[model samples]
Target: MINDIALGPQNREVKQYLSRSTRDSVLGDLGKVLAPQIKGRGTLQSTFDKHCIKDSSSHRKYWTEESFFNHVRGSYSTNVISGATIALLWKSFYFYAYHPFPLDLHRDAQIDFDAFIRATLLIVSQCDELLGTRELDWYWRQDTAFFRKASFVRMFRSIAAPDHKSRSQQQVDMTSSLSDAMDVLVMIGPQFMHAMPSEPQLESVARKLFVEGPPVAGGQVVRREDLSALIRLLLRLRLKERIWGTRCHFGNLVEAESGEEYLTEVLVDTLTGDNSGQIVTFQQLTGAIDLIPNLLLRFQQLWAVLFQPSDAIDKTKPQVNEMELNSIGGIVSLFVPPIDDDSAGILRFNQRDTRLTLEATTQVSPDSLDTSMSRLSRGISDDSSAYVVIFTDDASTSNTVIGAFFPIPSKTTHMIFQIQPRFRILRWEKTELSRLNLIKPDAKASLSEFAASEGSLSSNNAPYWIGNPLEQGAGLWVDPNKGTATLINTVGGCYTEMPSVGGTSNTGENWDVTIQQARMHIFTVRGSGDRKG
Candidate 1:
């Protein structure tokens, strides 16, 4: 009873017209062209609007003088601001590297320009290790250099070379230049953390700030070998400011190359409990002791380019502890090893409990002398590394304190956060065998052949189990004649998922037996049939 309405081939004219309409509609909507002419003209135009400037004056003949003047100023302002923003982005990355996770969660203004420079240098050092290139080459690749020199397109081009050079070399050159730029920045970053007195107030402050004693005697200066000295000095300054809850002001210095000056600021505060802006309280400072070295080392490298001394000339004795690690920031003196070695054996500064307790008492407990003294004795009795920490107080002035903890184990590797349970790793011997073929498993080896395995003991020369019954994580059917293992889980007409004679789908599943024993039994039965007497 059904009548068929058969469709015929479409008319060439109608078909062509429909296709042309669809093509045009799509092209118009997406701002593209039909196939074979699919140039991204629309995308290019959008990019031009955001990044390029094409004004009325460039096209028109009747441009006014006022309009021309405004354009020149506008461009200059844009370039300066953009360059600074690029520097800020580098600073953010520096902070992120140390605190891969929120070590100071819900903390604000944790990073400053000094920290930023140190972070960049750390990245360069890591890159150097991975690629065997100069430490500076890791920063300042063409892409990164452009970002640092944003709004100055030509500056980037000047750094990039077309021939006889690799990207690494170009990066090294740029980093060296950038380091010089950062030294000027470090001089001024601490000012933002606190306010300085006016010229009238400086007279009173100057006495307290100036050297009060015959300072630590000078030592032979080994310039290149003493990078740690300079780095430690900066760290001390940073820590001192944090501990005292004070602000530092270093006046404006012009950038060596640009000769342009900009204001810089650095701030540090600690917070406790739920409060956002409050100083971090004493109780909250407990775990921070472990972080001191990591923090100092990380920041030093990040901003290494910025702080490197500009002088090439070597001065033999530039005053040892001239830039004392402890005095610069609100940092308290801790043991730096190899201070002097006159004894039968080296008597280095060790971070013992007593030292930390004594240091803590001097800084924190002005009234609780008895308790502080007890703490010092008790602290020294225990054996652990001691660290000086800066702590903030809500009702009182900032205090520096010391903490003691056993050294972190060597085998421990840090994850970003506590996402895994702590476990002691068992160590084993390793060897550098010549032939990689030694890595291949012998056809005769079984699970028990491995030293640590607990399965049924396999003999030294026992042949490996072959055929379906022994195929792990899969069901197997035995081959009565030519015995050899074949995979059972593959999907095809040849493979089956049906229950075996043991009433289980595979060695992985068992009606009653344990999975491990089940696998072992299967292998044993299949492998030993011919060898059994």
Candidate 2:
């Protein structure tokens, strides 16, 4: 009747074969042979030879006791039982003896708890055979012995070692063991949560495994140092599966895309939500933060190896040097925000302009100045106009202003653009005039002529004022004699040589020629582009 309950569509054929009288008889006989070994009264070798070895009448003459033993020890042996046969036997045993199968069997037959325990013991005793045969389901079920105090430590050690297994086989065993461990935790998690406060034994085991350390076997000593190593091993296995394999478990909560993502989600949820119910401490929280840099460094090292540049020096060498490691360490250190202090220099200039340097020294707070003035007593010597530009610390240009000190004359006024809060004048340079016609015969007509025509300077200075020089769009023109010429279409802002009525050469009623100095460009502008006025 129990066999009537289907395992799945995939197992239908195996289920039918298992239900046959002949196969059932064989399984019963196999159980009889294993019962002695499970009870510790008989050897595993004798049990294996009785159940696993083929009859002499059969054509399989290679299935000898010695050959089966070699296969169990992870040696290459073609005489071992087929994987399908092993799976069928394991499922039959689980259904018949392991009382409460992990999945419901929908059977009315009473379960024999003693028989189930013995069956599990037998399975664990033959773990080597199961692992070598890649019987993952059976291996997983046997890990339930983790609850048995006498066997848990031994199981832990067994899972930790791969011995002579190949890399691929080792990975399979580690993943299977990890999954089983998580399943055991899930099975016990609810009971532990409900009774942990009152149960000292459970609490003691928890503290030993997670907090303190596991008890060492065959000695009175407890190994505290092995805690991290054990955790590292588990993490490495979980990470390998999540990173390279398609599916993996994150505790018993949910399947995750990757271990990294699972970790990130857990950390975010733990920190962001009300965690009064969670078993976390302040020390543990800070300890996790402290581990970030180290984790990042390790990840960087792995990434460097995984995604190494094709053109890297010494392509044959896979090892990273100390300098490279330190570089990665430095990158990891950036996770912590650096301390800010006013005592340290805020800005440093590697290259300096003598003129701006002179101006910086004269002002009490040159750095705080909103606007700077530079008086060009003789105006620009060349035909090109100068430009002052400010740049943020990130090297992006923040502000640009045409240098107004142009059209050689007795004196010219230039006003620097307002310096923004976090920006500084990076450089200034001579830029070609956007409007070369600013000095053309018609454009350069005297302000006196305009004043005479307009009746008074006060009535209308707009007619004599030249607006943005690059209004027509300026660009660079290559000249054979002069390397390049920056041409502009208009004069910089408005300018007039006409002195105020009651003003001296230095001071005026509304305009000062001497004291009210204009800021000149601090750096040179090179290359070519159109300057639109």
Model 1 spans > 4 angstroms off: 1-373, 379-533
lDDT of 1 by residue, 212-300 (tens): 32221111111211222222222322111110001111111111121011000011111112232322221132212221212222322
lDDT value for candidate 1?
0.22
Could you tell me which 10 consecutive residues in candidate 1 have the lowest summed lDDT? 520-529
lDDT per model vs. reference: 0.22, 0.24
Alpha-carbon TM-score of each model against the true structure: 0.17, 0.16
Best by the TM-score measure: 1
